[model samples]
Target chain A: MSGASDRVPLPYLREAAVALRDTQQRRNLATATTTIRAKRAAVTAEMPDWEALRVAGAAIKAHTLANLGHYLERLEERVMAAGGHVHWARGAREANDLVRGLVRGTGAREVIKVKSMTTDEIGLNRALAEDGVRAIETDLAELIVQLAGEAPSHILVPAIHKNRAEIRTLFLRAFGIAPSDLSDDPAELAGAARRYLRERFLATGVAVSGANFAVAETGSVCVVESEGNGRMCTTLPHTLISVMGIEKVLPRWRDLEVFLQLLPRSSTAERMNPYTSFWTGVHDGDGPRAFHLVLLDNGRSRTLSDDVGRETLRCIRCSACLNVCPVYERVGGHAYGSVYPGPIGAILNPQLRDVERDEALPYASTLCGACFEVCPVAIDIPRILVELRHRTVERKRERSPLPYGSAEDAAMVGAAKVFARWSRYEAAQRLGRLGQGPFVRDGAIRSLPGPLAGWSAVRDLRALPRQTFREWWRARGAGGGATPGEHEGEARDG
Target chain B: MAESARNAVLAAIERATHQVRDADPAAAHDALTRGYRQRGGASLPECLERLEERLEDYGVRVTRTTADGLPAAVAAWVAERGVQRWVVPPGVPEVWLSSVRGVEAIADDAGPRELDGADAVVTSCAVAVAETGSIVLDAGPGQGRRAATLVPDVHLCVVPASLVVELVPEAVAGLADAVTGGRPLTWISGPSATSDIELVRVAGVHGPRTLAVLLVEDA
Candidate 1:
């Protein structure tokens, strides 16, 4: 199993963020996120009981997570009773090896895959490739990313960063088609993908998937998808192996109703996705005769230990948080340097890995509260980010100072000392007012010198007033004359 | 190895439970039952109407007929599409396909490759949700193996009026036996479609592009 520490270091994430400030990437992210946001608003507004449903969704998840060990035990028993084999993997490497072994047992060297973030998280394809097995991604977006030799940038739409023209060029280049003959139309690209993948689907004897929801009572695994690729992979293959994070288990089948409604609207902004396939273990010659379920714990147990951090497990991977996140919109997913991106990634990666390795992730957010509002499970993402930030600071404080302890840390300590007493605070403010003369122009500081330069480079800061509020109040004689309540109001305004 | 991994993770979970305190199982179950509505306030006929309209909205051709007219409707459905070969799963009644002309109904014992060779597939649905315009196939008598409906390029599903319900909950309730019986269920809303490219809705991808649902009403 691989830990979150497998991620690129903090400096890599910072460098990626700096490099991805290109206007083209910004335009792509802006257009895609804005479109999804509008669509989500329209569909969610159609439901009169949307709020009630969200509350129910959160309750069900909380109840499930509180007793995950119990539910997972029940789920294992049920799946085995239904004639399916269950495997427990404590880490990503073990999960990948287990799946590869299953495919090898079937004597097949190739397997078709459904669009699963779990598979990506485990790096299953790369692992399989090392063992001389071919793992073909059948989802159109996934296929596009695979052909372009690029990582998926978005959760729902992996190729969200790529436009139609780039896809057209990629298809033609990868599939040996003449560029002059291929069109950039989406339909044409979809047709080309269908033609390319249909043969692989029919020929492959093994299929791998990730479950959207696994019901413990009925031993059923549900996969929600818009494209038909999932159906082909789940139905036609002789062997099926599904790798799921243990967090995806629900207690009963009836609980599916809450998630079915919440997932479609929140993810794709649709009343229902085009297809949702559910299969228990194996039916008599109906679907795959051999079924395997891998329950992965890789770092989840550690995450569950933190009361405040455990809520991250309730996430359904709907990508609703990603679409509404302003920081994600600007920096894009690649900058996060984790399979899980956006607000959920901000807290999740740091917990899954250690806070020190993914330290920069917590600061990637602006705490705008858009992600929290859009989350179907009502994860207070801003609160979690703040908590993670606190943890990061505490970790920093515990470490001995080396070449640098961070300039911001020194500034914060200095401000804390100044805020301890009123006279010292007022004097510091007066000194700040006088020192702003050189940098201040047209009442705004466009750029700053020395340590503060990085902050002002991207944004403008307004200069301090000539007189402090206390000075103005003393000059007016209003502080001593006004009542306490009225003085409080004036202080609040100031 | 698997047992050791399981033990290690379970030990971790048990340790965490001690730190935060696990809720009682009974209390958690009670809290999970939220007061979500089972059915939208629509009449039976109104629900059925919405199902047809919604399916059609996604480009599925829906035809309504009584049991007596089902045979002819099936014949016309096959003939209009100019299908020369079609396969019917095991449980579909012989009477439904008897009137169909100029088409051969492939045997249920046929392999998936043989099923794929056919132009279309005809099967009866276990349950249909009226509110969502979705059909549930539980591999019941009429619905053969899951691959029967999936392998063919065109699918014509029969949903009896008796089986049509107003909401997802009602449809789920109707399938308690199938659920516990351990049969596979596929809930199809429309023809297999994709919004993968630019989030544009495209009708035909991997599943049957042409889906025509035959709503057989009792005479």
Candidate 2:
């Protein structure tokens, strides 16, 4: 998706360290995400059944994914019946090739694009460039990022990292508009883009898009957006190709009711976005005359295999999780080093890629639960992150060179021995208490030696208590008649 | 090769979700607990009033008129904007433009060139949602094509009382026909907006900047 590699090159800590130094990105992310967070809270609170809607959204996605193959077949049949063609893509290469061939078949050198993350995930634009076909991003943010030669920092607002002045400067250079002719006003910059792309929208014969949701019941593809760019790309082109991730398909038309309400409120924090387009197949005289839907598997089936992490597929890409994530706020999206960034990215990136390549992503969250709280589909992202972390460690241990594995594995093995029995654990605790004299300061162990030193460096590990929990429990109120409040008081005192 | 890819993908999905692959997808879907509200509690009058309020909240200039006064309202909007060469798609009432003298009314088939050159496009909506203040065009009758409403500088939409639905669910229930019928639809919540710049709400973009709605109440 980044065009150079399928996997993030460096670990998350390395990427995050670089991103943390960019104060502009951090500030912009904080402000944008905070604003959206408040707005989403407001709009969602107004609905009495907001939680129920979330439940329904989760259920719908789970059901669809459970029968993903069945729904996909139905979608293909319905799309073909409605005068559209459906193609299957096993991976990024296949999906990109399909889109490239479709655009080439139109005999067009340049194609217009709606802001599609799935297309970005497959690197379709670059793939098309190999054949000398140009794909122009029509979304305002996307166009800005394209001109600046950058990746989209935010899923919803791709140019969230760019401010008005940067945009104005970029447009002035790219469109060759004189300095006096353009202003840093967001509206003025948008107007400049409109003027620049209006002709392109009308003239471009091929358009590429990503589906927000594809209804299997009616074979309709839904795209929800604020600007009319999505409308332009889907409507004005003679031939439209929509690349959809397998999980995007929903079981029925009525399911849209849940998503339409959930997405806008959770995505941009509005009751509804400015524009949403739904088209099925090819209309005779309106919109696209020819339509192609490429169903891209692209490791999605692999993601579905993990029962704990499968809820990651339920994500609608609303960016609610990103906006609410504290880690995402400070480090911004770039640190995740993938098209997806934030808590959802933390879990999704690893699951959708080779786990070893993205092992660091799963550990990139504070587990504050804000992302899970705001997730429109109830993705349980925190739970998924924990599960992925476990897998990452397990995978790493399996691939270690030593038969006995690494030091971390040795420590875990030793801990398992001691923890397996209460007597050994008690003996170890007594040994830890005896050895803590040098490290304990102000009742907290601020530092430790060797491998434990790294874990204690960033956090305070409490000194081994003078008495253990079992000892305390035996000493305080041995009778079974003790009330919970009494026990809380005694525990606090102890 | 394509069929093989399709078969492989299907097999992979079946293998991944083997727990539910053999179960009836329809049954699994139907068995889902749809706890969300199906019907909005608003009455018809409330729906109309809310629709006007919400549409106006989106910066759309809204006006109300009876079915009889709709043409006069349209004439007022046209005169107010000084719109010339308006593209009136098929199924728009001829009387709406009969009162407005100066503007040249173009037909539905005016090429993209003509549509881009036109000052405005006016059409009646297929349905309107009260909760979100959104108007849906199903490329039906007066709605013409998606380009008519999109390419023009200004879009004036007519929302009839009977066509208003109170919530998103209610609107989708009726629009399923259009989806299966292969009528591509556009739901315009307001004139174009972009939150891409620092996620700040900025109005007026590539789509029509000036959007006005005429809500006609039944007499």
Candidate 3:
């Protein structure tokens, strides 16, 4: 069985910083993100009431989460009444064990898998492998990642890190395609994947899936996707096991109206996705004779306890935040070392794994608020990032010997104290100018001697002004703020 | 083992969120302001227009037919597409396949391999969404097993005008009973497609690569 809690590798910053130098990775990310960004914008613009849909989505999820116990009970009853089995898993190990037992009951040595983040989060493939069952990824991007033996870097596009040429090369090595016969064309590569996985789909007897949404009232599970692989995995198999995070449950089937509009536009930027498969339990001589729904909690209950962090549960896994994240565009997803990455990962990983384990994550963002802008559920990601950062600092403060904390923490505390009072701020401004005398060159501080040096290394930093904003406001007659910079500078003095 | 885990998680959620399970769903739902439109408020002709445009946008081929002409339309399209064999759902109207000649018509009772061997699968839709250009099958009478629509390389979904709705919510509301009754539902919009490779869309992935929708007029 897989471990219950997923712990991210702690070198997020170092690896991401290193990856920033790979011009090719940067180019791949920039091109992919830009294309998705433009498409999302165009589709969003087409719907005049997009914001209304977002608000409705957030409200529905909030209501579902609030009454989760009732819905869970109701869903269990309905699914069981419909001749399907329901297994509740407190964490990943329980989920994996349940799935393994079910698959074993079917006597299947291999299974086809739909693209699911929850499966990745729980390391389900590894657990299946331990049981001598091979789980093949059918999504083209996921297939590429599986062949390359790399963790998914992006949620929507798992192989977004690789360009056409790299994928062509990987396909040549992995799929046994002759090098000269393969080209760096996307359509050609996709055709090769379709040909390769089609046989597996026809052969596999068991399918393991992760749900996009599970309607409580209907006892139904929904898997939305662009590729038909999800359909193949869900339909062809005789036995189907769906492992879903508890937070994925929705109160009603009609609630899909709001999500359907929000998810496709927010995720793939399509008016509608290619296929959305929804199955309620097992059918008589139809698809999947046996159906199993595993409700997985993992660390979600812990996350739900935090008022500020709980909004992470509202996420639909659309990855709109990732496409717009500046940091994600530069460093890519591998650096996060979590199934989830980008702006959502920065806040979500820390909460799922807790602040102490993934402390470096909350600091991964510049708090640009682009993620919040595009979030379909109106998650307020920037606010959560700040809250997680505060939680991280608090934990550090409690762990450290000094009341204030480390050198960087001490500097922040000192700055806060000075900023709390106007006289202290002016005094500090004067002190900063005087202290920068040694480092100042050509009206800028090109580099610093100590901890602050890291900031200036990547970009030129302008020297501290000779006069503070308070001084400038005073000279501009304080209230006379008609000039352009006068009002903005005066606002800063507040 | 399962019950205890289920209870534990439920208890944890209740304790952490401080929310009881007894909240009245109707009251909560009533309080919610679903600021979005329930329907596109388009005329039938307008909706059909929008549906055709949206379907075409997704690379689906949209064909029109009268109540009495559906079989001929289906047959002609199958012939034009060079389909030598096709499968029909058990509940599909026999009259619709009457004009289909020179091609073997198989039953839905076939296995996935047999279905996959067919050139195309034809079935009727439970509902159609105009705004999103979607056809939903709840595995009802005319619609066969989910595999019938999925396994074959081509899907020809016959949507009657009576089943067409102007918005997704309208179509979803119509399926509420089926959804609650535990029927398998599949929503198809165009053919199977993916934009995973460099964010460039390529159609005909894993599901039926070609989707042809026959919009039949209401009797």
Report the C-alpha lDDT of model 1 over A1-494, residue by residue, as the tens digit: 12322445445355455746677778888888999999999989877778878888888887777788888898999999988999999989999999988887888888899999899888998888877888899988888888777777889988888888888988998788888877987877888887788888778899999999998888899899977889889988889999999999998888887888899899988777878888888877677888999999888988888767668888999999999988888888877777888889888888887746588788888999999998999999999999988888777766846444666788887889999999999998889877877888766788889979876766678777665557757856954554445644543333
lDDT of 2 by residue, A157-234 (tens): 888988888888889999999999988877778889988998898888889999999999888999999888898888
Each model's interface RMSD (Å)?
A: 1.6, 1.2, 1.5
B1-219 per-residue lDDT for model 3 (tens digits): 777998899999888777533358758966887989887778888888889899999989898888899888988998899999888888998888888888887788788889889999999989998888899998899898888888889999888888889887898889988887878889888999988788888888889889998888663
List DockQ, one per candidate, in order.
0.65, 0.76, 0.73
Give me the chain B TM-score of candidate 2: 0.95
- Candidate 1 clashing pairs? A1-A91, A1-A92, A1-A93, A2-A92, B91-B141, B91-B142
What DockQ does predicted model 2 obtain? 0.76
Candidate 3 Cα errors over 4 Å, as ranges:
A1-10, A416-494, B19-22
Cα lDDT tens digits for candidate 3, A1-494: 12322334547866776788889989999999999999999999988789999999999988777777778888888788888899999888888899989988988998999998998888899898888998888989988888777888999999898888889988898789998887888888888899989999998999999999988888888999988888888888888889899999998888999999999999998888988988888888888888899999988988888666568889999999999999899999988888999999888888887645578787788898999999999999999988888877777777888755866788887889999998898888888878888887766678888878765665576777665566766766967555547545543343
Candidate 3 Cα deviation (angstroms), residue B199: 0.9
Q: Of models 1 and 2, which has the larger lDDT?
A: 2
